[model samples]
Target chain A: MRALVLLRAFSRAKAHTLLFSSHCARRHCHAPAKRERAKGPRILGPDLPDIWRSPPLDSTHPPPPLIDANQEINPTIIDGNSIAEEIRSRTAEEVHQMKDAVKKIPGLAVILVGQRRDSQTYVRYKIKACHEVGIRSLTAELPEDCTEDEVVDSVSRFNEDPSVHGILVQLPLPQHMNEERILGAISLEKDVDGFHPLNVGNLAMRGREPLFIPCAARACIELLTRTGIELMGKHVAVIGRSKVVGLPTTLLLQRHHATVSSVHAFTKNPQDITRQADIVISAAGVANLVRGSWLKRGAVVIDVGTNPVEDPSSEHGYHLTGDVCFKEAVKVASAITPVPGGVGPVTIAMLLSNTLDSAKQIYGLNC
Target chain B: MRALVLLRAFSRAKAHTLLFSSHCARRHCHAPAKRERAKGPRILGPDLPDIWRSPPLDSTHPPPPLIDANQEINPTIIDGNSIAEEIRSRTAEEVHQMKDAVKKIPGLAVILVGQRRDSQTYVRYKIKACHEVGIRSLTAELPEDCTEDEVVDSVSRFNEDPSVHGILVQLPLPQHMNEERILGAISLEKDVDGFHPLNVGNLAMRGREPLFIPCAARACIELLTRTGIELMGKHVAVIGRSKVVGLPTTLLLQRHHATVSSVHAFTKNPQDITRQADIVISAAGVANLVRGSWLKRGAVVIDVGTNPVEDPSSEHGYHLTGDVCFKEAVKVASAITPVPGGVGPVTIAMLLSNTLDSAKQIYGLNC
Candidate 1:
């Protein structure tokens, strides 16, 4: 058991590609000969083995039961996308069942600073989702030049306002504003992003859940479990160690009884280690990073990356792809979440779920 | 990896014990019969394996470098008795450090609801420890019939008082009063006991530290580290999964990178796992549960149990013996902490440290 960990001690995350049979990829593209292999710092270059070498082409062990690019059998696809649809319909029904007809609505205040396009899209979608769910969403788009006091003032207003059940500041606030301070200012009850270290810490510990669930982290688990994937007694491999993904995912999985090994950018020979997993979740942004060759047969893959790759055929000048190299993986894997459908929709579903939770908490109502 | 994790699914809090011949218990006690061996539950039992059952018990697979418990050495014979006196002198110097002369002495408001004799003793020691640390210690003892609101009122008063930087309400409040209500009311910033779910959650997370440290938890780490015991890359087996001890202790050690395992009452074979550890920290209230036969050669054992065992020979009529069978474990363990002196003094020391940290946070000085 210890021998495998030691063997990978000097290995690093590699860009894996599958030598797809002629039936796949359709052309003699001969996927870019795996390049940019990570290697330890050495005075002399190209010292020994290639750093960017593609993962082994040899199929060694019996393949894991997984959902790769080829295996498009995500449970949600067959269930009529019913889980999310139920949530949306429930939100509609509940909103219609309000107390006053013009009752103290679920109030969510979002603070956005600067013009980061991604943050803007997230905020926009959140507000739209809130409105769709009959939540009164308030947007506070402050200028990049705004001071820390300005952000704190906005948070203070939401904290006192009985109308507001949640306060979420769009992340990546201007450099001048202390993210911790701005988040902390949002009273614990109203801090809906749950990015407050206290919230994050609370989420990690036993005996309690977060006041406002971090949607992305929760979504990763939801996608995995809803597909008849039980967490207990499973060997799961998670890539990425960001506070948002890798670390939180590990804590959540442990809570559910999965013996997990974490691999990040600093991990050695991550592919070989990952190949041993019953489930693989990649949140790292490296594009087409996970190829069929890297996966254990039938291993479930949930790609959280939303990287955009250049594709002239798309009107946007580029196309969004997942961390997985889909075509080759589909032939060997069992189940896989598509880039745009699997986790993305679940993220929104959880956000709505958390907002509903926030409303229930504030109103002393049971859900 | 999958099979071991499943067939040997174990908690990571306190794991890895007795893997060598040194684990043999002393002549002072009888070993548990082969038929009565301690085994963790088949599923999530205590994380430690009975290391004594493993092979190559010597230099080939040594005890963790940080611990190096000389199972053959008697701590009393090795000057461990002087640790208390040495601690006393060091604590005295800290009080006289002169940095707090002009400071508004940080105060801890300790509230006791019921008159349990043991509770009284614990509180008294804590108050005295605070005094020795040059901090103001306020005592508020309420009647057993006190209402929940009354308890909350005292906590509110302490929270409002600028002088109080820490608050601890003695445990086992009367059954009539809601413990959660009283605990939740103590300001999170001054919760020194760290029983509040918020505090517990914070400490459970990786890359997160509680604002006000948990005393016993911190003490375990401090005591081990002060004695030159490092946890990095070692495996620690923790017995007990109580909120106060087993669970938090596991989280604390994991943060230190000691592959930890947790064991609770439901564990099928507890000692079988403990035998594999480089270190064993047992907080289970069970008496003499861990014995020499279950230990690996030279394993360090930190017995956190303060269980009062009947002993007519002692002045108190009841004497404290650790969860471990001390007499037998003493012969096998490289270093073993005594029941009364080992953990007790350090727990007080850490409480003082937390009070000091609370003061720094409150005053924003010398942090």
Candidate 2:
């Protein structure tokens, strides 16, 4: 399984190289103009690849240009999509083995309350990933006006189900509902989201192992580790302290022996702090929050922000953007993760991986 | 109760001023000679007050000089003993009121499993503080070679005891014992030490409050807040990542909206990071780990280290030292806490506070 994953990763890297060559071909046409702009303060928006952009039909904003045309330096793009794919493939193989050995497959149960488009899309992606890995997926779709007890009932039912190895309650339950109370109802063993206080506490302490880590935080570390970015003894500036990502990422980074500086809204002169870091992880959910000046030269950038910016050209009428000013950061940073294909896909892969681990624990099987 | 505590604090502050004046008179005797040493790198040992030092009976190390001879600045000496006394007085008044309003009092049960001198001293202090605050105290002294189940049995008994509002398992439990398993057995409600993962997890997350925060971390925050030092938006360098003090202190600082940089042994240039902070909290346990150059002038210093250094003149054959080089820091920092008299006393006070809060919660009392 390890060899298979490595083989997939190697092929993916080669594919990434070929794709970059095509981007280089497109960049040559505007190389002269780009070099002039690169001399001054970079005011350019993210130069996304054509493949990542949609057709301009009744578009409000003009389509962003292709890759930065700077010939002097091209950063090694940390391909999170490729890494997530490798993880999913490994999880699939393990699920297949587990099923053959015990005639038992991993099961994930999701309770998504309300009809929030973003939440629905997230749940759909999760279910699809579960099915791809041969994991049984169960979902309870509650009305927008559902009571707190209704959500608890779904969680309780899933907790009692022997077949359900993982339970996730999609976040941002209606403002009227008590999110913490509902989440607290989930059984510790089946909390694949790893939102339980016990799990989080375990993660924070040294010599203690959390049963599961939150998917996005796990994704951040996985991307760095798999990409051979050394964390130990390195200075990391984690921007934002949201419970789901920033806070957990800080705890996990400390566990890995990285000296972390947590930057938030209350931070004064955040740029100076970020510039001092060996690595900068921006999860602030603010568009273009981290500019070129905010990072040190050769710093590794992990963009976890998935802010939605209006784009009528896209089918969803919006495009996902990252916290980093991509065009500006790519010039200063040695390596960087792109918005839509970066931490987002890897986060989903982590969810599947966690679900498989949960099932394996219950079945007493080791992959 | 509040007024009484304030009055006691005012008296204590006045007494501290009187004590410092006599030290100033002593400093005048060696003013000319000490002035020469201050111009250099300031390689002086802690200038402890005569009251804090024991008589030099079989003295090996020379008696250290008095406060820094530099007359240009005199930092506010954050007398934690005075602050802790204020808290204890408040708790005592509240406990007294509780006894009047109801016939019950807060109870704290401590389980000491080993003969480690430090643990024993800490447990003794806790018991003494509880008694001083009018809270009931119980203790179980187990042998060093006691079985894990034996310790758990004690915890279980306390967990079920209606009179026991708080349970504390004195740390560094024998090498053979599984500490996490034993601590996990304690009832969450009675976990006054707040070592439980749930409490830690809650503390790490925004919009969530832990039932109890670790005592030393609480002491760090209380010392700062009571001193009128604003935390919101301030840059704080937390040296060390120990679960008991450093890690929790970092989390709590973040919750208070402070941008915190966690510097550990792995950090390449901890001094540079510490120098950049408005506040520096040293809990690294290394004696004088933070030097004068590591601090910014006018920065607030909270030294939580209580490291024991050999001192033949002292009765105990050792003396408590802080992580900061006091004589050096005193010249630079705007405010600083001393070693033995600083965080140590307040930690015990917080444990008492937590026990009182736990009992109040259980009894459904507002106070």
Candidate 3:
């Protein structure tokens, strides 16, 4: 990735934030708000009015769905936690059957470069998921000051081990290290994160499918398809253009024949674009970015944002929140995913699924 | 390409049409009219009005631009032939300077797998361009009955040739051959066509640039940028989704921060969507598919289609036409690209530029 090249040019302080800030702060909170909100430059014409913006919803339209965040009878609240449990149960059964036939179970290796609290929590969740699915979990925890070569060496060890069917490098390696070099070092066959360029290329292309889709991206699409929501010809606006979630998810939606619009940090009037969408998937990781007014009537919303906001009243010092203003969006959306229990659960489930697939592929076993 | 894999599974007749029909018929002309006209499957909530369609140009709206299909006084006609000639001249000067410095010039090797007349014409044009630019052009002409292994072997020879800085394998190879295998065999370093997955991956990524972009796709963007057309925040509707042109172009546009909507064969009511776009680039190779009614009054239209339609008045039985109906669209669009003289000429020039770039990269010379 070009990020590797830029890292070498970045100042020590800049590189530190670039590499570790995502894990340390939990949100892309580095840039100045004014600078970030400048909006992308206009290229099509001399400043045109935003044609996508819809006027305020009037009573003539169907009344806004009831706004009751605590109510259970409004729109169908997608139960991602339950669906993930179902997936884990099925994966466990498959592991059991595979162990009986091949005398081996799937194994996952996660290489954590630093002791960032957030990264640690994610790594722990993945290991727990593997355990629940009856698969072996191995972790290589390196120090904060570890060399890039050292990180690669740890990955190489797992790549060489026949028992390790899947390898995941915990992201946001130390500022001093080259993230692309270490990630690229992972053998493609064992790359469960699907961050490898080859896998991404295959995903972007037609007539070619990625061997492994990024877990979070796959989970978002899985939620829609599993819910029997047809994707063909739908106008799905994706709010976020990050490599991990937004970009790949757009490609996946396109593969399903959905007309996708990617609204990123530079997008002008993102709400206007989201309102026209038949389905909205936001992964900007900005708390309460999407509000009730941004939704079209009966729009399906999938919130991939997991921003931690300060909450002194809660047991923890902070509480996780989604990009959408869930309290308000729930009243307007036909279906919506809740933070903490939404895409997170399904993402872990997908990691387990990918691991099982890798093991099956290695053994030439049919599912 | 997935088309290559599907070729293996297709009946011989289907495979023949799939691979050779583009060359034989000069466009995607085999499908039934009804099937081609049928709207894409519905995915967004039930049948809805064509929301994207704009009303006819009236007094309320600005009057249509001058009706000037035969005249050249309204929108600036992008003179591809002149621009390509300028590119060739500059490339020649670069080759001269490099030869003076290092006593060597760039060499390009082209592998022709079959005797398709259309394919031959394209190959000849490339060779002529190379000659004009003072680059050595090597041709390896294989028969129609050549095996897939033979094609790969030909590419391998070019890959090993230290003198060759660029390698191009003309598309629409013989029906019996595996297109992907042969294309993939070309060394990534000398992939002038830029179809390699690595190059595509780089193109799709943010903060990353491809070693080489597909020439035609590059030409399209080059025209926009060279003409001082701003791309940022523009709603660019791309009317094709082919790997060679549409898909890569969309990725390139996104890199420029454009809000892009990809309209493809599966897109329903494409006219509605096109009318809403500030800029439209169509590459479906469907003659006269875009009409005046489909365009915004001041939109910029780039037609990449070069479909050969029956023309009794011409010396040849057919003449080239574009996806946009020039007569109707020219009156509506602020700027428009003509069929044969637009993207086609720029494509040949881009190949020269790519070859020159390859030489610079290989020789460690700065431009």
Find the candidate with the highest TM-score and give its number. 2
User: TM-scores, in order shown?
Assistant: 0.64, 0.80, 0.79
Docking class of 3: incorrect
| B110 Cα displacement, candidate 3 (Å) | 1.8
Each candidate's interface RMSD (Å, one decimal) is 22.7, 25.5, 18.4
Docking level of model 1: incorrect
lDDT (10s digit) by residue, model 2, range B1-367: 4334334433443343234222322110100011101111111111111111111122132111223445356799999999999989989988898788778999999999989999999888889888888999999999999898999999989987889989999987776666666777777667889887767876786545566788888889888988988887789999888778998898888777788999887776677688789999988878888888777678899999998999999999999999899999998888999988988899899888888877776665662
lDDT tens readout by residue for model 2, A184-249: 777776778888776787678765556678889888988888788788778899988877898889
Top candidate, metric DockQ? 2
RMSD of each: 19.3, 19.5, 16.1
Docking class of 2: incorrect
Candidate 3 ranges beyond 4 A from true positions:
A1-74, B1-74
Mind giving the per-residue lDDT tens digits that candidate 3 earns over B1-367? Answer: 3233223322332332224321211111111011001012210112111111221121232223334445443666777787678777888998999999999899999999879878998999999989988999999999999787888889888887879989999987765555555776776667778786666766776544456778878878777766667777777889887778988888888877777878876655566567667789998877788888787677888999888899999988889999888998877777788878888988898888788877776666662
Ranking of models by DockQ: 2, 3, 1
lDDT of 1 at B336: 80
Question: Which prediction has the highest lDDT against the true structure?
Answer: 2
